[model samples]
Target: MNPSFAQASPQALVAGDPDQGAVLDAALAPLRAEFGTVDLVVERMDRLGNWAFVIGDMRSPGGGRLDMSGTRFADAAEQGAMSSVYVALLRREGDAAGDASDAATESTAAGAGPAAPAEAAARDQAGLQQEDADPAVAAETPRGRWVVVDFAIGPGDVAWLGWPQEHAAPRALFGF
Candidate 1:
């Protein structure tokens, strides 16, 4: 785990609206598009009272599954950031979201692309036997856990928390 990452316990965060399902569904659109479909499982609320939802395992047409999990933010800015994180994870891993023709060409030709080398190197460095670089596996690997902690914080209350990174992405993705 990255030392800079931190996350509140699921018990620490709380949801303000139990019926924010529509809001959550909208916020999750990008992820749904990328992962084929998404099922929001409200695992727990946060300390600050924001919904903490999880993206349950999503099955793919290719007979694989993507097991992504993250929280939703009702606030538009927070929602945008969360969506970006999910998209970035997919883009970084070269997973198809139905865009980027280069991905297919790269995948078929020498396995070269933005993420392929790093992924290959990581595998080599870890000395793990190489498994198929299937899109399903890339989607399923929990890049990290995330939470929308600061979304609910007032401007004046921002200082009450540690640095944003302590409660945000990278760390959040790992569910710390």
Candidate 2:
């Protein structure tokens, strides 16, 4: 749902091709470097709407169950606003920026805090595998956890690309 305006009706968000000329890569670059283990997806807010997009991250590799939903952006302005928010978040989360993309992606709780014993061990092991990368980058790429860092969109074509948010509802973002 968009935070800036009430949803006029029940509209579903669909996945979009970030590679298909969407102007989000730059805003998302920092997040891409920080959360390297997940695939970040941008989706149209609905099959008919064209004024908004939503951002979500898939912790799964290639594909998996347990659909994840991300935040909503009412327009390109909102997308830019969220990008700044994410950059700050990435920094607060001990941002990393090297070789994290090589790590395996997996689903994790949206509100996960410190790792449990089992999760900690797994993160430690994954960290070890990334010994060749910067210690900070490897150390911060928690195994099975991710967050939305940024988002954007292109001209709406009404095709449900099945971006991450398509599988479920989304969170209101930026209050506009």
Candidate 3:
């Protein structure tokens, strides 16, 4: 079985708090508008190493809730693989560049909110080149392990994969 095909938890539509809702709505608006209903599922590790903010469809291709523990992204190989997958998916969706920028912008904006320093830092960290500044890049995925796949049905079957790695860490380098 393709390990990458493992399922992930379903993401709930944001609720409560108009402000938070608006932010989420705005953040996701472009995606919804552009993609016409995406099957996005996000799972992040919390301080306790437990999954948090799981979202989207959870059913796997084989039929079962995706086992998050088994979907490993801690290794560089996994991260690189996921990165390539994400880039491909983005290219297919025609919204890769915009997505990357929005992600970085959102992070920086949340951290500093309209400050030059923050914006500049975000730009640098995002690894965006002059060619990437075009809005069209949003339609193309970054040249990495990012993959995109069409699952054919079930709560936005499209997915963008990413694995966070810091400085090519040893755990990921030697396949620990």
Candidate 4:
């Protein structure tokens, strides 16, 4: 464990570090935009090379809980509030000499909306199957330019093969 991370409270750890804050803010932007203001209670955080996993829950100001539902997460809305997992693959602005920044800019300009059909098809053909492939592995390919792959909210037992690590701390935290 990083001594700093181990010694700090979850909120202090997240609030005190710029990198973690930026990544978490970006990852949860869509959720925030949709749900309005909500509280995030962090359960665990783990760091890999330049990657991070944040596991937590989201609660409304009135203390109502939110849940995930789709082909990717809880599979149905009734499953209730399992924890949410947010993964970020961070790269400092100059690390790739503008490659990552340029891509991030393009995505930002696009409003981070869902890709067009053709673009989605092309991405799949290019081996980035956003729905079926393991996000961790996809982020590791030559396309390390992925800054924040955003968040996943579910229980560890859910068959989130797309993000196999799901709620668990990243494997590297175990020296794997």
Name the candidate that leads on TM-score: 4
Considering TM-score, which of the candidate structures 1 and 3 is the better prediction for this target? 1
Which 10-residue span in candidate 3 carries the lowest summed lDDT?
44-53
Q: Candidate 4 on 42-109: residue-level lDDT in tens?
A: 66554453445555567656667654433344444455544544333222122323333354356656
Candidate 3, residue 5: Cα displacement in angstroms equals: 41
lDDT of 1 at 11: 34
What candidate 2 gets wrong by more than 4 Å, as runs, is 1-22, 45-54, 64-175
Q: What is the lDDT ranking, best to worst?
A: 4, 1, 2, 3
Listed in order, each prediction's TM-score against the native is 0.24, 0.22, 0.21, 0.45
Alpha-carbon local distance difference test for all models: 0.31, 0.29, 0.26, 0.41
When summed lDDT is taken over every stretch of 10 residues in candidate 1, the lowest stretch is 86-95
Q: Per-residue lDDT for 1-176 in model 1, tens only?
A: 22331233433323553323323443345555545554433333232112233323223345353333332233543434322222111112221233324534555466543333345334323322222222332221122212122222112222323422332223243244
lDDT of 3 by residue, 1-176 (tens): 11111123322324452222322332333334433444334332111011012223333345553323333332433344323111111101113343344564565446533224334333433443211121232322232211111111222223322211211111211112
Q: Candidate 3 at 94: error in angstroms?
A: 32
- Which of the two, 1 or 4, has more lDDT? 4
